[model samples]
Target: MDVEKVFCMNGGLGENSYTQNSYLQKKGSDMVKHITLKSLEEAYVSTTPESLGIADLGCSSGQNTLSTIREMVEAIDKTTYKFSNITPPEYRVYLNDLPTNDFNAVFKILPDFYKELNTERHLWSQKLKSSIYIAGYPGTFYGRLFPDKCLHFIYSSYSLHWLSRIPPGLYDKEGHSINKGSFYISKSSSLQVSKAYLDQFQEDFSLFLQSRSKELQSGGRMVLILLGRRDRTHVDRGNSFLWELLSRSFATLVSKGEVEQEKVDEYDAHFYAPSKNELEHEVKKEGSFEMERFEMFEIEHYSGPYMSHGTAVARTIRAIQESMISQHFGEEILDNLFENYGNLIDEEMGIEEIKPTSFISVLKKL
Candidate 1:
């Protein structure tokens, strides 16, 4: 199935909702605030549009998107002070995601967001000032969403790892999954399995660049805060094996009459973690954008008030992966699956969690 049709973060403001479970992604946005601010500085000083067009691509709804937008607006405000000729920017904000995403959930929270924005505006200055207007764009980012040369800035966070579709060549001559038992590109996989995934990312990411190249005005910049890997040479085992534990959970059901082994065999997560070198290479190959900055850093996972280390880890994984997994493995398996997955984490790991590497990149449209 295409990720566009099936994938989305857990919706609503419930405990399992992405809004509650996305602590690490929130931290990611905070860690990369400098990149967003820098991009705004360059974009405003160069283009200086009276109204800035900003698109937050793959913008999963939660409390986070609004704060990020506020931060960007603050960045724009800071930029305006340095330029005497430049007036305060009126922001046209576009929040985009797949059509299946929970846009209603996103929209439902807007009154509060507007109140906060108004409060901030009043606090920032007593004078009549710039304004922000937000709209929803429901579509995948692998293709163009906006008209040519309109968007001045684009931001995507903890996305871009999702391929537009499952990698081709996953099934063999007999039409069975060749990547049996492995849900992702594991260290032990054959070169063919690895190459299949690499090819898909290459094609999808190139198409992404091509699409955005058409949308961004000259000097327009994009800041992508992404999930990535540490080693330039390999998809590290620690990074790729989260799904491995989940698959083992299915194995317990396969032992009974609960799930077919074939179902387990056919699971592929439709996700890939690329290294910084691969991103740079793709940008060079596309030739439509130049890389301004690329930094990879690590984030340590943790437990919180609502859950333990193992439970928090499982919830975090579920918020992103549950919909897809439920579609394939049956929703009935979800509770048990996560329970066993959490148990596995407790047995193998301790209080301290391994840090997952993430990347922040800034690219300028040529």
Candidate 2:
């Protein structure tokens, strides 16, 4: 599959859009706001660049996209005044995501974003001397995306888990799928399936670090918040089980002849939730950045204000995975598939508590 073509969150501002369903991602960002701000401040103080370069990788469309950028700007603004006692540097912000991302939505909202920034500046009795220029950069982050030594602060949230492409070796020489009946690593998957995923992540993440190392200035800082696991185990009750529920939803569709079994067996999600050890190992081995801070937190699937936990989780997953699912399984099954998924989540929630885990890391470019 061409991941660049079909891999994108559900776009636009509709009920099922990522804009409406990204509260959980917002919450995780909030959890690490302090760390992100501190890291950015430190990077700015160290460099004192006349024109500050900041890039938000995997910055998808919506309020969350600009909201996070706004906060980072605010942090730099205050830090410049507090430490350097001078006007902030000229801001050059790059908002990046896949080419298929709904950049139109983001572009349309720029006026309001600028207005809000100006209003906040006035409310704080601050005289701005430097202008903030924002631009959209459409591309993948797994490779080079910027000029050498141009960025001082980089941020990516809830996006690193997505592999550059589906890992190879899921099928044999005869093209028979090995990870049948599951879209991700599961208890039933063979060891080869698990190793393939880990290898892909290692390659992608190392390339990510290498690319960013070239783009980042010395003493630059990058804050990464991604879905993660608590231990070395490839299969867990958190994200892995969520995929299990999704697989069961497909099974229900197949059983009713709504979708073909062959289609289901041949599909696999291009995502991996790595452990803390896995992240540390890669960072050390790559030798380009120093790990400043690392944290792990859990977001309960049932914490949303929706009428039911299942509805909330279902909406969130749909906003993220609908594009891929529709491209593969046909858009006709989305409603029934999510309905079945929500029901399964409700049943599972009644019996056991499930909370998805996330990680926040602060890396300083050496």
Candidate 3:
């Protein structure tokens, strides 16, 4: 399935990073620091490649993507001493994502990127020696995004679980009562939703491996930073928490006649949160790559009270709201909903609870 279709119904929440350029860039920079330092250390132990290149899968239109590129270039420059005998090889980068993603927005940021690089050159004589040229390509990483044996490093975050589309047999009736707010284990939730999501992830990830196995030169490395569950074998585990919260909110909306019950019922996210074991199993299944590191850690995110809502609006609340207020609920409704949701979260989790995000399962393709 086309990648865009998988993200078709996604609420604008993920896109919020496009507007908060600094936070997103900082995130990418941190990721680069972690991955690059590790990759360099690993290369020192094993056969080190003469050249290094990277691809950021799901590089959406935002500062995070640009920050990642900048960090990569800087790290490479600092690490050049490690390859003292050999000249730093040229870097070829491919930035990939869904076709609907705003590639032009990323392009708009490049001029500034060059300006920064030029500035860095003036500050550090070493920067003048590194030869790095970047190119951006918008496409689905579910398939090949580059020529055979072309990549040395690949990274993806918050992108792997989206199925190509909603499953065919699933649909909510017109009244929105039946399918309203059904998750993998809710009112309309069934094993089918969970299984379908998992099946698609496996299929898509398998294809991703097949593509990477051919694209990555021997000893190339790839890192997938995703939201992963702790237990893969837990039978009751699924998107149950999300379902519980969303269903309750929708049920409230239905009682108040704010939205059709059926409309809520019809909506289902075609996403899966794989457990670490599940992700590891899938990677081994392809028999193309070896795990270098597998770690799970959480990060804190401040959503001002909106994200706690767990309703439709929570999915799109940004760090800053500019003018897209119309696509979400009216300002008044959003305010009330967030107030209620915030109180509920405070009651349940206390005032200090932070949103948890999972880190990466770093892999090296041999």
Candidate 4:
């Protein structure tokens, strides 16, 4: 698949758009918001740069992207107050995603976001602050996007689990698709299938660091929150069991001749969750950044203040994956497929079930 062409969050504020369905991602970011604020705090205090340049890698179109920048800017204000009791520095924020991302949707909402941000700053600062410039950088994060030392702080959440591309060896010796029967690594997948994913992640992540190293100033901080496996055994280990049920739903469609079994077998998600060791190994291998903090935490399949209804989880996943899936499978069956997925997933959520966890890594450019 040409991920650069088809990969993107569902755009606009519609029901299926990521803007409306990204509660779990927002929750995870909220969980670590303080940590992110602290890193932003340190980015200013540690360097005292003339201007603050912040980048959100894989920053899809939504409030989630702007909200994160709002928090970072607020932190810069707070940290500046504590340090010098003076005006905040000039601000430059970069929102980056793939070339195919819905940048127009993001741009449409910028006026509102900027107004809200300045309103908050004016109330506290007692005077107008300098313009908080926002720019949309359309490109893949797999390579360098900015000049050397261009960014002082960076943040990415609910991304990074997406490999740059599908793994190389899904087709076995028979070349008929060794991983044909599964969407991702399952109990039945051969060892080769598992290693192919691990190797791809290691290569992609290492290159990710190398590219970022060129853009980040010395002492710049980065916080990356991504899906990851708790088990030290393999790369494709944790998915909140969301995929298993989705795959099961496909089997139901296959039984009714609504979908082809071979099509299901031929598809594997462009996703992988690495173990902590794997993450550490790649970072160290890349030789650009040093880990300051590494942690793993769990998030519910569906999370919010109110009791989440049955469809929230399914809607969220569908918003993110439906575009890619429709490109491979026909678009006609998505409604039925996710309906079945939601039913089974809702039925299967246990009160005490161990949900898939996210790996939070805080790094500093060396």
User: Total clashing residue pairs per candidate?
Assistant: 0, 0, 10, 1
Tens digits of per-residue lDDT for model 4 on 137-233? Answer: 9888888899989899989998899988888777666756777667888777789888888888888888899998999999999999999888765
Residue runs of model 3 more than 4 Å from their true location after superposition? 1-17, 21-33, 40-51, 168-180, 184-188, 233-240, 301-347, 351-357
Q: Which tens-of-lDDT digit does each residue in 236-306 have in candidate 2? A: 77889999999999999999999999999989989999999999999999999999999999875556465
Task: Please provide, for model 1 over 1-366, each residue's C-alpha lDDT reduced to its tens digit, 9 standing for 90 to 100.
Answer: 767888999998887789888887887788778878888778877888988999999999887888898888877786776667768878999999998888888799888888888788768765427788999999999988999888999999988988888888687888777788888876667788878888899999999999999999999999998878876655554567566777777888888778898888888878888888889999999999989988888766564676666687788888999889999888998888888888877765764455567889999999
* Model 4 regions lying over 4 Å from their true place: 173-175, 234-240, 301-310, 350-354
In terms of TM-score, which candidate is strongest? 2
Q: How many clashes in candidate 2?
A: 0
- Evaluation by TM-score, superior candidate among 2 and 3: 2
Model 1 CA deviation exceeding 4 Å by range: 82-84, 232-237, 351-353
Order of models, best lDDT first: 2, 4, 1, 3
lDDT of 2 at 40: 92
| Per-residue accuracy of model 3 over 168-198 as CA lDDT, tens digit each | 4354344232333564445445655556567
Alpha carbon lDDT of each predicted model: 0.83, 0.91, 0.59, 0.84
